[model samples]
Target: MDLGLRDATVVVAGGGRGMGLAAARCFADEGARIAVFARTRTDLDKAVDDLHGRGSPDAVGIVVDVRDATQVERAFAELADRWGGLNVLVNAVGPDVRGTVESLTDDQWRTAFDDGVLGIVHTVRSALPLLRRADWARIVNFSASSTQRQTVSLAAYTAAKAAVTSISKNLSLQLAPDEILVNVVSPGSVASDSLLAWARSVGVDSEDPYALMAAITEHFGHPAHLPRVGLPEEVGPVVAFLGSRRNSYMTGANVNVDGGTDFT
Candidate 1:
């Protein structure tokens, strides 16, 4: 299905790798002019090259930490200068920390909140003006399945993501008058660098990341319906749809791309 994203100007925070990069590639494939934002210049450059290879001639990468409102504003300003206006905003920046309530420190909680909750707040606030200027605008927020099914060691992370979910719902109501749709996309376990690091930290073997992930999932995350873990690409298309003009009637909704993990 054509997402009606051709020539649309899109901004994807944390688009250097993982699910963010996957979504960026999907949008670009549909002929969207993409601006991928990340903190590391090297990662941003690599992501830009990858996007260009995926047929995004107008794709560009900017170095911006979503934790900083000023950086987010600067990035959006640059995007506006380059693309004229924004049609889609994907908030994908998040910290990879995981800890149980007893094991988590105050600093860890603050850091996770800053990255997961405040980051979305900063990005959306900076992008609102440009989004309002577009003929059709969509906001897709990346959340985790943990928000629905509380995990043993993800108390802080889940709380932060829950805050993001609330923010998305509120923003959907606030932006509805301007015809901007805001929604949340919650993804299940995916094979990414962050996941690999998490597994290693938990004493899971790092030599074979997928094997470790499989073992962990079987013990903790195995759902009743799906027999395998989800892929970043699998989640990306859903996010692209939520951020596309094709999604006209959906707003303030939480769509789970969790391989049928019964999140209710």
Candidate 2:
């Protein structure tokens, strides 16, 4: 339960909101030194304060768009100067592009790849040196459950997430020699604020998270065995554990944090 994360240096690329912030909270509660990256300065400031309140000895929030390699590099440079090394890198950024393959435009596809795939690439590329300098290193990248399950109208999003999963697998193998464990966390529909807004936009006005998920399953066709959608808080501990020093041998694996899915 300790997770061996006290004083560990961690970078959460999308740690300003939703699931990313939730995962960062887990590390914060474990007393880690956390650096959170996100574009919105307000959200980053709020997250840093919250992390500090949650027990992080040191927490800094950086305003950086992961889609821009230069911004990402600069963010990591600052992290390097402050922490000297990184023990864990958690990439929680993902594009929200969703549509049928035919309905999605070329620009939308490019946006998906740029935000979901290249964003991760930028962070990982910039963080490698810092990770390598640490005594123990881990990378936990976010992927979507739709990638492993049969889902509808998520071609672009799924494609981008699939690339993230593949990249993590490859990184796991390549970094094995350095003892840097890499893994993926695939989450099903969670009742985040955006998801709640989406549900309301579609007239699925249900306050209950489980009932809301039922409506989503009935309308949107993404079903899980648990009947209810997972929560941001629910996914956080799994990510924290995977990125912790205790997770020594689990690498190149996609851990689905969905309520329950048949795929794996």
Candidate 3:
């Protein structure tokens, strides 16, 4: 599947590492021009080099914190100067705060919304003009499956992702006339670095994907029918397809990549 992504310009927020980096690699494999933005310069530089090795014609990494609208605007301005237009925007950024409603502080709640929801707003708004300049445009925003399944410990995180899903749906409708497609991807447990660290912090002490999933299920109670956590590579294809010209008619949909969740 070519996905018609060659020469397409893509921007992946939080693409310095983890699932965002995985998705950027997918685009790079398709020979896309890629720009990845994140807070860490070191991670961004490494990601850029990896993308080039993966076959991206051009890969640049920007250091920007999505929670800050001013920084996001400046970064997008730089993108416009480099590419002049954008074909796809993959928002894989989110706040890592976790806690129950009662346990979470007011600052934590604000941080969650600011980084998760408002961050999406900042990126989408800044990218819209550039996306409109392209012949085909798509937005793929990451959500969480726990938003649907309802995890007590992930209340703040899930709530923030639910807002992301809502924003994507509304953007799909609002951007239809512009021929820009917007969609949401809700993922379950994936054995990414942050997740592995969390697992180890809780005494899971395993790097194996299945072991991590088992521990995750026992701790978080969000087990899937497949009985294992997914890998970052497993998610890249779905995001690539969604953000590619191959996805012509799908928009305003929340596609679950949750290893066969019970709710779906």
Please write out the lDDT profile of model 1 over residues 3-52, one tens digit for every residue.
99999999999999989999999998999899999989999999999889
As for candidate 3, its clashing pairs are none
Give lDDT tens digits, candidate 3, residues 71-166: 999999999999899999999998788889999999999999998999999999999999999999999999988888887877889899999999
Q: What is the lDDT of residue 125 in candidate 1?
A: 91
For 6-89, candidate 2 gives per-residue lDDT tens digits of 999999999998999999999999999999999999999999999989879479999999999999999889988898999999
Model 1 misplacement above 4 A: 200-213, 218-224
My TM-score estimates for the predictions, one after another, are 0.93, 0.97, 0.98
CA-only RMSD, every prediction? 2.0, 1.1, 1.0
| TM-score between model 1 and native | 0.93
Full-model lDDT for every candidate:
0.86, 0.91, 0.92
lDDT of 1: 0.86
Error of 1 at 146 (Å): 0.6
What candidate 2 gets wrong by more than 4 Å, as runs, is: none
Off by over 4 Å in 3: none
**Residue 179, candidate 3: how far off, in angstroms?**
1.0
